[model samples]
Target: MSRPFADGEGKVGTWVNEFKENQDVTYACLRPVQTTVLGKTAKVYLTPFSLNDYKLEQLKHSKSLSEKNSNYMMVCQKSEPKKTCEEILIPKMKVIPSKAESTLQKLSLGVHDESNKPGHKSPSAAAILSADMESSDEDITPGVDDFSGLSPYEKKRLKNISENAKFFASLQLSEVSARLREMIKKRQPPKSKRKKPKKRENEIGCRRSMRLLKVSPSGVSLPAPPTAPMLIEDENPLLPPGPLEMIPENADDNHELFKGFLQTWAEMNKTSSKNMEEELSSLKSYKANLNGMVISEDNVHKVTKGSISSVALHPSETRILVAAGSKLGQIGLWDLTQQHKEDGTYVFYVHSQPISCLYFSPANPAHLLSLSYDGTLRCGDFSRAVFDEVYRNESRSLSSFDFLAESAATLLVGHWDGALSLVDRRTPGTSYEKLISSSMTKIRTVHIHPVQRQYFITAGLRDTHVYDARYLNPRRSQPLVSVTEHTKSIASAYFSPVTGNRVVSTCADCKLRIFDSSCVSSQMPLLTSIRHNTITGRWLTRFQAVWDPKQEDCVIVGSMAHPRRVEVFHETGKGVHSLLGEGLGSVCSINAMHPTRYVLAGGNSSGRLHIFMKPGSY
Candidate 1:
């Protein structure tokens, strides 16, 4: 029922006129009513257009369409193209001259200075050197023409000079010129001219005028002209020409010598001073009631299969993730917030032997790392859901490892055969450097300084070694510093996390040592040494003293005697706190602290993890 509309006109009504044809529907032109009546209004109508008027309207509409099309076409023709770099940048660039290239060209051309010209008399070597030394340019002339008629020795010297100039031109201009001047000065012969003392004119005049006094006829001397008194002692003395000998003299000994009495005064007071500090700490702990309360506990294995060797907490304590490794090489991860057996736990079986250490990456809290006695180190990234084998060895066993927090990419790994290696995560198969020694029976642990990332401390058979990571080469046989104070095997040694002002070590000799590490270049004074009971049962796990990240002055360690507890001691040999009573149900052998929060995690021999937060936090 619909027809397509035309562009020129739309017809909705039909009309038949004198010169027109009839149509089905034609459009009616509208006009306003000229007048209106009250109560009944007449319908409005429009006057039909004549032929002339219709023609005029059509011309006007056509004229407007032509003007718009012309304008559009003109604009399209006038547009400019986009400019490019070839037109703008090429003209602005200027050529720059290189100093090295110019110098090399000059040396190859064999140019000579004015001093070495054929017509001019050749100056002495010292004079030529002095003149050229004052100039900015370091170019040397070899006098090539003079060499044609000279002896072979002189020709050799000129050839050397030419070669030297070429060598200097090839190096960095600034540094090479300074070094060349120093070498030239050292090669020059010493000057033979000494500064002649100014002659005394008055004395010469006196001698000339009184020449007749020398032949005194009557044995009488003529009166000498009055002269000024010379200060013989005030004149500068001549320095010895050659090396001065340090001749020993038998001068009088005024030192007060102490007769054969052994210096036991210092040794006698050292023991008494240490005992006094221990008694003081005991009194402080009794009055302060220092104790920690546990908030929760989680079991690594449902039926307690094997002892738990290590435990680690994520850096971010928001959603706590407790990862513990067991003696049978099984690693269990639990979401502490969920606390369910099946739904909240994830287990990994990566090693064939027992696990030695477990830790979370400092750079990423979701990444976990584990080391085992089977000589394998592995990393698991939860974000990517992939496992990566970081390192492996067929002969040596990996015991423990620590990440360099500063680099966030390097790891220091210790082995059972007294070997240490620095492994980069990006290149896991090859080690960057390795250290080994015959005297080192076993490497127990390796700890990097918290503040100085370039240095690390290690505990071996009965000694501790400190090394600079930058200078550690495979062929180097010595460490930067060594500490040998324990009789039995040393368990672990660490620098203080805050300020790195002190070092604390736990040894199997039943002793804990504190040293002043504030200045490593000087002697490290032993601040205090305390008797600790480290003897557990034959098959028990060895206890290690770990520094609390929150407090630099206090350290926490497990107890092997009496009630089941973990004790904390001040660096000054004072007791800080004790986790005793029903709060801690079993003995804890391995522990770690939350980096930024007041929370602690511990593990026991029965495959369990114990968590303790601040008292008010629970």
Candidate 2:
């Protein structure tokens, strides 16, 4: 959705005028605006890609207060597809001068630029980082005397003016101080000695005489030598021998010494509250990533059990069907919003192996299909996955499976053999034919054109391909365009639901790319490419790229990498948001169920099918 224009196109003017322009954008926020460390001075504005998205945000689920703590945006995806030597060479070889890549190269370079406080890394950002590093150094930690860089006056001004800033950095020192004290409190005090009290000689002598009389009365008789008090030597004054007196309770009632401590304590309290809120949000994000099962409208039918491979709803009605996996390999069906099944609830097991991919017909929601790695494609008849004897084939392993939305006779499959095949699955009770077999070297996912029945796109393990599926007859399928900007294997790709001509892809190289077919011929052309990242807990795998049905340009993608990320990228590929996923697990597969809404089903070797769905509308 990037409408890349020649730079310097918009004239700077008043805010209202800027807002009214035909092609206007909110000022490109490089970063979020923040007050200085003590909130006294304004440093710069920052646009941060807050890592607090993808959590449960349904009406019933209250808005998380932690989300407010996230103060960043404009996340950059990693390296996107680049014009490869192959793509670049083709146009030049044909004597058709390709558009000079200077512009695109510049744009791409800018997207990857670390020059300022924008994208992932920026100069100002780096400066802030250096400041942080210096502050954290054990040898240089700021204290009462560490004034290596600041003039005494500047330091005093910083303390006086920005000391009361409500934001975080303003009270960092105080917060740290409180934390230190907390740690110190965890330690027990060492034992100490006090001075022994002295007595007068006469008092000592009288005490001795009493002792002798008492001893003699007890009949223990040893005559005391002179019965006089012995002289005592002066003990070292520095060596403590007795209890030290407590300082007076009201000694120096001035509270200045504790002002900083109290400030720190307050800051620590604020930080703790913020942390608790974040923990709660993280918990919700965790649930959102794997919440594939939902109660039927009537709440009578429950979709549960082994990992759910797919969830589908009737195209026009309230009927829903769920395909799940079990140790015994079973797929279940539930009548959501309906209670008229001849059987109270229908359950069926039609495969001996775990279900790999499943889908319901766009034409008739009740009708569905299932494909397994076991080399089988099973069609469904409302209640169960009945064998479609007509379209079965076992030539190679099937990695992905789906039916074209048009009541067409085609089924698309990406195989382990690194080939993509569009099988004519119209007939179901007999042996079938190989409609079309095309290879992409390393294939990961294959799906039909949302609006163009004639074309289909294949996200290869390393590249992206657009094929003319109408040619599945061998006479029709031919390459429309091939994109190889990604240097690594592409894990997922999606054509914009609204803009069929535009495509987006994510790859192992940690990049997200956006392109339009119309501009594909422009040589160095693409709407845009983004390269920032989130979802940093796992290795990225089986991914699904999707467009927001409501806001056409909004997009979301699931990551298979550690701390699997469900990132949202804007249509222009300029904006980004990283959300939480089930766990650090590889994503097996992903697909969109509707234009505005979608369902995600993926699992790792852990046997848990992680399902993410938009909460309410679906």
Candidate 3:
């Protein structure tokens, strides 16, 4: 058997056989012709027939065929055709002139052409040589385009150069010498323009009146100062000048212009469905006494501590458990139902360092969680009458913690080292069930949304971050939202009990910022910020602004601007009330509201507890 192979030429073919191994394979050239095969037109190549040695011997051995029959050639098997040739490209060296070189050439040609003109005289060889061999010390001028993208500094330097040129052009030789001498002299420092300080608030109305004394030939008569425009009522052409409806004698009748007043009034009345509406309505009434709640001088209780760090009121109204934590690691418990005697209060030493935060478990009212700077988180169970250390680590200091409403046994604790750990009470032997590195700064406080237990917020030294507890994993590092509007350290961040849509954070920048957390934006929008005085006391602890559980619109924060007072602010940034008196002798930086009652308690730096009650409360 022989096989045929196609070479570079599509028409050339070579045949190889085992019997002719020593002989060179014969090749045939074929001509391509276009012909119709089946129903399609195609190109076909046919090889011409030719008899080789093998075919000649076969004819001689047969002895029956003529030499004409020996002319027959056998066709070999079909083989593939050679492919088309491809074009090849080779790179070559080429010279291209830059813009600067081309510009220089053009300039040189123009100069040469000008010199050769009939009206121009050609320079001497010496002068031409001198022009070609420029001095190395001479400065090179820049092109116009070079100035287009000059930096600000370069542009300023150019402007100064232009100004100096103008100045020199306007000055004489003597004046120039004098100016140069002056410039060479040591420059005197520029005088600072000091701004006059604004007058104090108390001096605004006490300014002395300036009198105008006129000397009318006798120097005795003084005319009144010139008067400006006075306010005068005029008739508006749009409104007919009829006798004004004084007080609307017919109370039920509505004017044509104010016909929608009744509809708006009805719509407003329909919205007064919640308790918040009633509270707001009460404040609007003339008889309403927001000041009915005040710290009485006789109601002050003193604790044996230097500074009160935190305070929390129990959720029971009948039997109030006012727990106050101090920097001396003492927990002062005062039973408000008992008499105001020294022996009536119970004090306990639970931590070695100052307390940071105190929270009463919502699931178990008898359980009180206390966090201290000593890196211990203990729960004082009233039902068991014992205090148990829930968690403590020597390396990581516990700053704050809150029970997750999603699971009562699950607690979210914030550490001083910027990690938020999820502690499962059921499995206490293991370390943190899940730890999340929320920030690079220490977490100051952690608060769970009162309504959405699955979501919690951690107030770090840098910013406040909101995370979903359900989606929290040890590997998860991102939060749902981050609020960084605070310019200083966030002392505390809390969600309103009535509605979790609003979050209030007290910042060390002396501001109480209210944010609308319910907004769909990535960052919650700040509703309002109230100006507060957080730096009044050097030794006093920072105040934490807490939302009144009774009214989400009201925020209560310790007032440092006043000698002794607590300020209450509405979400509109208005000061609604202030509990100020001589009883609060020092600055009160820690305050807590009675969860179920309309009572308030504040602790000062000296550990004096001040209590305020509503009307009729003894």
Candidate 4:
């Protein structure tokens, strides 16, 4: 019921009235309508006549249409055909100016005119309009401004744009913006030069402790006793201890001199023993009187060559004998009471590596024990004037050792490979009584409970554990209590010196933690965690927090803070005192307190010893 009409140009269109029911329709004559397209006016003819009539009209115009179709088909084929300019009918287009074009014309003319003025169009604008209408399409060129053709509105707009450009140029904002961009680029690193993350390989096997390996016992040998050189009256009195020398050929005369030295050391052991009642009373009444202590020039001395790794105070009340060990495997013994005699110091090369621990036997002050990373534990016997080898392990290096009972012969030693060995000096061979593997990677420190001698604690990596000596299994011993809140490697852990009711630890996370161990169980509650800097870099020894032997509630540790002082804090995280002096200008990484005296000693990385005591106590 519908029909489509096609014009002479072959554009088909639908007639809307074709769908009506009325059939009485009359044909209308052709007419033209005026319409504008693409800024050009043209006439379009529309006829609703019969299809036969439409075909007849198309036939009449076939000649002209064929020529136009041929040209269009050539263009579609991507080919150009030469034609005379008279045959090409170019449509007349109306010119409409844009704001940018008008403004550009004003800028080219370098003039400004008021748009609000009442008058006819400017003569210059009229001239440019006439020229644009008369110009041919082929004759027009781009980027050519008509300087003489600008209206008042365009001239005003051009004036405003020029003023803004001049203002910005005076401010020099473009140069400042360029410099800021350059600075930003320099501050940020380029993506191409950034470091790429390393790919981690899959671990193949589980880690096994070195103690589990089966190996033969290491050979143990005793070297000749080291002897000090005789001092001459004319020698420099402030000189350090001379190197050890071989005994003279006259062994008998040398033996006599050694015996006299032993006798004098015995006479210096004048510590009076107290009963349990008096000892408990004294401990309860002990207070840290830090204000009364002073560090003077006379109390400071260089005891060793390399950094001091460990320090121990002798328990003799009649004399002040401080012993220190260095990373260079040297042991220095300083006698403060005999400062005027031979410089009051003696240095001995006893080990081949760094000494990790030093302690004078409490049962007999004559025997001083020292452990070194060279896998050897030696005892300096003043009575015999010899360093006797007590234990050695060639398979693994020793890390820490402590006395297990009142008798100093029984010892508990920890290895770098997470193994614990029970050693008895009375035994003949280099073998241990019992060896047990632990659940740690490296045992950094070990401490036996003061009252409960059978209980001990070990610190390694990021964990600290307490174990009982009676239930240790040879394969894998279980811990009685474990403290795992440490976020970094634990430097050291120790029990209270008097009652063993609390444990204090120093961690590389810059925190000092204390645990209440009044009743040892699987869960030991954390008492306090104090924010203290414990990060001693590679060139210095690690900081360790140790308890005051006289006061069970107080703890002492070296500081990395300015003014180079040592800090003492109570168990509740309150600062008790900070020992500062002009003579102490370096970080004291290792510190120790006298067991029965009011004396404290700190050792620095430069091997210097600083002593703090009552001004006239020495």
Candidate 5:
């Protein structure tokens, strides 16, 4: 038997042997058409049919013989026709000639290879030459030899180039283009000579503090002694030697001058006190008096080296003495009465950190007490011309302090860690008299009640708390009155200076709250909540609302509004007066009012002091 094979016309056939019952052997032809074999579609061609009697007998018995046979083509199997044609014959590979070879052949056939010729030009250059030689006619045609060796794309590109050249020649732009090229070449900026950057010295590493560098595992080392001082004549011959000394050469004379100032300060404070009943009755007139106060050129002065953190007024009604403390721990004393003498200003470095509080002793007006974040509380004893360490807690920084007793010898101090310390000046040591722990995270301000000496209020975190001094315990002590309405941290809180009947608080939520505290044993009811801008950004000190010590019915607070001014608001949530002046440009974050005088002093972040007082009152 022959193996199956496909013809050139896409036809396939096979030959097989037939089995006959008559014992006769013959060849049988199997014809094929488009049909499915197993599962795949296949194209088939049929050969001439030759069947034996046995096959004819089998066909006669087949059931499909009754159906019509189309041109004797039998369908063996059926399947769905494919959408695409499937080639049964292998495709012949067609060889394509190389473009370079064809082009070379074409050039060899009488066309010259112009690319290598010295006199030959590019297609674009040739086009420009032809455009210069030919007339401007749309129908102008070039010789067939010009483009015979080029592709259709190259020929079209040459035609486009030639047309562009003709258009430029018609516009007479060739000379202009040449002139523009010449001008561009002539106007080209000269290359700047860049100086080679000097190789920088190795960047200096950050210098650590001398104190830190001197520390060792065994113990801290003290700083080395200073070198000998240079003579004034050697340093600057024009400068006077006496003023150049850190310690004045005429120390005795300076001491005498300071002693005389102290004596004058004591004598001014000796003025008799006014009747309390009469002053309290004149509270309305006092508010009116504040309204009429004016800020003059002499009233504003730069008193410290940095932002003022605390301010105080001397308890002298006969003279205007203002003391201010700065964030850099400098204390400035300004006397309005002697403004003509060296601007009446004296500065002293009293602490190593920001001064948190400054107060003049009511009992000894000459002694000015100052508290600092350096964990030191000192009194500027004018009589002794020294800063006496009243109390010191090296473990924690002091936030604020207030006199606890009328004698001004007992002090109540608040620590940054929300602890309280009671200090007595008469005690021999610098340690606190008593230390009380608190649950608050921080204590921003502390104020003692004027009438009720045993009661005091503290403002910090998100609440203001009032505590009874006698009942305070280290283990646990409950607040007598907790003002909890503040949604944010409270900056400062103070009791009415004379009667302690009202409490004024400033909060980070931009509100000024006044509480009625006449009945101190119970919760203080919120009397008024006035909207105010208390947001002083990181560089400025926080705004604190304080009370007019002379007027119990009004409160004084710094304002952040434009046309910068300090505001005095009544306890009933009404604006009493807005103190504005020409020299008061910045927000006065810290302010103080004289106890018995009609004087108001505001301290700004730049360490300047602005005072407003009735004409000639200061």
Candidate 6:
């Protein structure tokens, strides 16, 4: 059988449009004929923007009338509504102009009844002739100096010689001249230095050497080589020689034996000198000691912070929310929202949690991602808390979880059983297990790539895995991408929304490293390396790092450092942004104030939860 659109005999009816143009509705002779050429009724022509302004105005008016009357085309739609996008666009036109109206066409052939100028290939015979003649008559004669001497003709030749010489000298090419007479004629006034081309690197170096070495650091003339002193090979380098002796190659003349002796002595004094300089600079600058922060901001306002498990803000970042779960399996969600109304009193009791994990669902406003300590992932409705239904999985432990805002059906969970499960939340009762890790090490963090929601990027105890969710729904096995960078367990891995190709990982070594998600290698180097301390068993898992919502170059990291520290890394993503001036102390979490930016709200081992708003000026 032939395809649906194929004409009989397999000859495509390319003139179907022409055939339709002449056809008219003939339902028992009730509908009349319609065609623009006939100039009867309201007829529109289909062309490259055949709608003149006047025709458009008429069509719009007709459309409005049809809408108000609900009689004309509306009846057909009601009978058998055309629901497809193509069907809806049939009566509309978003016309692209023809060649004649395009810029280049308009330029070549001027508008307003002018014959558009022919393009270069069509240059006129007359134009070509004129150009040829002009070049032939004026350019090839020998230098006029060939005719220099006495009569009127001779004087003219002499004047020409002087003018040509002056022109060449203006270009500074007179130095290339070998003839004495031409050189004499070229004696024009010297040109100003305003137009010199910039000097090349080697030329610049040569010039600097000639001008600088002639004077010493003390402003006294020095012999050639401007003093390359014999630099003592300091085992511990001393205060980099006095400011005056700090010149390049500061050592060449000292005897090797003496240089060695000086090096040994210099090493012992380096640390003391460094300490003195640091103390001096610290004394001069206004220092900020953020040793402690009030984590439970206005402790009275806190909803019993120690029991708090989850906190997130609206996509708009206008509010803050917190969820606390008690040992009694009770979960409580409070409006710890930062907007303190001077006049309004609190109404209380939103949602509570004996929560295992709180995942804010970005795609659906009415939903949230919830993990019960019982190994169940529930889709909690915003309106009430019984949850739509229980999604129980007993295969492995649901250790941690995260959600993707772009996909309406995905649920990503991390497991202590060493599996990263991608659950289908839409049909929660009949949960579809999209992916379960094949590895044996439990995953610590599960993050789904927003740009590719079908890909679950999970951090396993030993490696990071990127699973293509399409593998699950389609029953296809697209090999997962596993990156092993962290020496010990890979506790966390996050990809920035600004650029999907980059990701960061933190691990047991108390170090944070960045990787190009596209390439995972033993030689994968970090763009930024940060270490916490030397303490053993101090897993980096206790800390959290979040990308700055307002700037792609900045990342807010919470550290296990004593008195705690929130390191703000700027330009660490791409060298374009530099690190910031201050760090946060005792911060446990960085969450959105609203969906736009975040306030690092965290507490320390001291049982405090401080809310530090990102600096407004940043």
- Candidate 5 local Cα displacement, residue 275, angstroms: 2.1
Error of 1 at 593 (Å): 1.6
Query: What TM-score, to 2 decimals, does candidate 5 have?
Result: 0.61
Q: What CA RMSD would you report for each candidate?
A: 43.0, 46.9, 35.9, 23.0, 24.2, 39.5
> Model 2, clash count?
49
What are the lDDT figures for the candidates, one per model? 0.56, 0.43, 0.59, 0.68, 0.67, 0.41
Q: What's the candidate order when arranged by decreasing TM-score?
A: 5, 4, 3, 1, 6, 2
List pairs with backbone clashes in candidate 1: 12-25, 12-26, 12-27, 13-25, 13-26
- Name the better of 1 and 5 by TM-score: 5
Q: How do the residues 419-444 of candidate 4 rate in per-residue lDDT, one tens digit apiece?
A: 99999977765535688888788898
Q: Work out the TM-score per prediction.
A: 0.51, 0.42, 0.53, 0.59, 0.61, 0.43
lDDT winner between 3 and 6, please give it: 3
| Residue 38 shift from truth in candidate 1, angstroms | 99
Off by over 4 Å in 6: 1-296, 299-301, 304-310, 323-332, 336-356, 428-430, 472-480, 518-525, 534-541, 571-594, 603-608, 614-618
Residue ranges of candidate 3 with Cα displaced over 4 Å: 1-289, 428-432, 615-618
Give the runs in model 4 whose Cα sits over 4 Å from its true position: 1-263, 276-288, 429-431
Best by TM-score: 5
* Superposed model 1: Cα runs more than 4 Å off: 1-292, 296-304, 339-342, 428-439, 615-618
Q: Write the per-residue lDDT of candidate 1 for residues 1-618, one digit (tens) a residue.
A: 111111112112111121022221221100010011100111111112122211111111221212222332233233333432223222211121222223223332332443243333322332212111111111112342232333322222233333334333343454555677788889999878988989887654534433555636566786777899888762322222212221112112321211100111111111111221222234344325344445533433231246778788765534555677888766776555553544444555556667888877765655678888888787765544445677777578888888865545888888888777778776545545455442366888888887787777788888887777776666544566778888988888888877778888998889999988776645467898878888766667788888876566778888875677778888889776776655566778888876555567777888776776655532
Count of residue pairs whose backbone atoms collide, per candidate: 5, 49, 0, 0, 1, 29
What count of clashes does model 1 give? 5
Over 154-243, each residue of candidate 5 has an lDDT whose tens digit, in order, gives 332233333333333344444555678788899999999999987669968787775677765566786667899867653211211111
State the displacement of the C-alpha of residue 35, model 1, in Å, after optimal TM-score superposition.
99
lDDT of 3 at 617: 62
**Cα lDDT for residue 116, model 1?**
44
- What does candidate 5 score in Cα RMSD to the true structure? 24.2
Report the C-alpha lDDT of model 3 over 496-585, residue by residue, as the tens digit. Answer: 876588999988888889999875236688999888887755687888899887677788898856466788888889888888876677
Q: lDDT score, residue 74, model 2?
A: 12
